[model samples]
Target: MIDKERLPQVAYQVMNEVHEEEVDLLNRLENELSDEVLDISKVDELLNTLLEHTKEHFANEERLMQEVFFPAMMMHQGEHIRVINEMKMVVNRWELTRDPELIREYFLGTLIEWLMLHINTMDTITAQFITMHKGGH
Candidate 1:
């Protein structure tokens, strides 16, 4: 597992623990790293962490859809599949480069942006749908 440490809250998850894994890494990077230990290993870990994050988020969203009998479920599932494929392609390229910095940069810049957009758009909808359909306590 990439980023053995739990992460900090980068996404807009209603749950706090959900953000812990990434938060831990943010803290670690801030404390450690002397331009030497920062190698492709970190990149590999972050990539794996990203893949895991994607999987978890996708699974949760799909589960919600299945429970709700969501109409746009197919479209959302398609998007999740596309995201996995796109990230894998990027990971494949980064793998060829053998540069941790490139991976870090990609994750920080592009991945974060893509993730935020997805969360704001798709994730938000899922959460709202679930909450609304649940008959509000």
Candidate 2:
């Protein structure tokens, strides 16, 4: 589960909403992984859901950045593209191997670490830029 205290303070309300949804999704994924039966299908479903949500979230953030003429928009969008591609690779590998342990490792290691770092640094900077231009609180 993500620690709320660790989340950056963003002035945009929608950013906070998206962050909350991400936290919920992460918690759900963690719970699903903890099940003793280790349902691969369920894991696949959760991963797909996370991927879809992340895509939408990134798109929305990108749209906001574009609307506000954010100087770092290209860089931010590139990061989003990179992360989504990595997620696709992970999902594809899992589909081929059907290895629950591999999925677990990817989730607990790569995904979580990337998300925390992105949110703490890139997202935080983007949100601040958007807020400044949009006159958001």
In terms of lDDT, which candidate is strongest? 2
lDDT of 1 by residue, 1-137 (tens): 23423222322344234444544543343333336566557656756776787678677668867988877889889988987887788789888977556555665556656655665576667656766775322
- Candidate 2: misplaced stretches above 4 Å? none
Cα lDDT, model 1, residue 36? 54
Best by TM-score: 2
RMSD of each: 5.4, 1.5
- TM-score, one value per model: 0.69, 0.91
Residue pairs with clashing backbones, model 1: 2-45, 6-21, 7-20, 7-21, 7-22, 7-23, 8-22, 8-23
lDDT of 2 by residue, 1-137 (tens): 66766766677778888988887887788888889888778888999999999999999999999998989999989999998998899889989988867766777678788878887788888888888888664
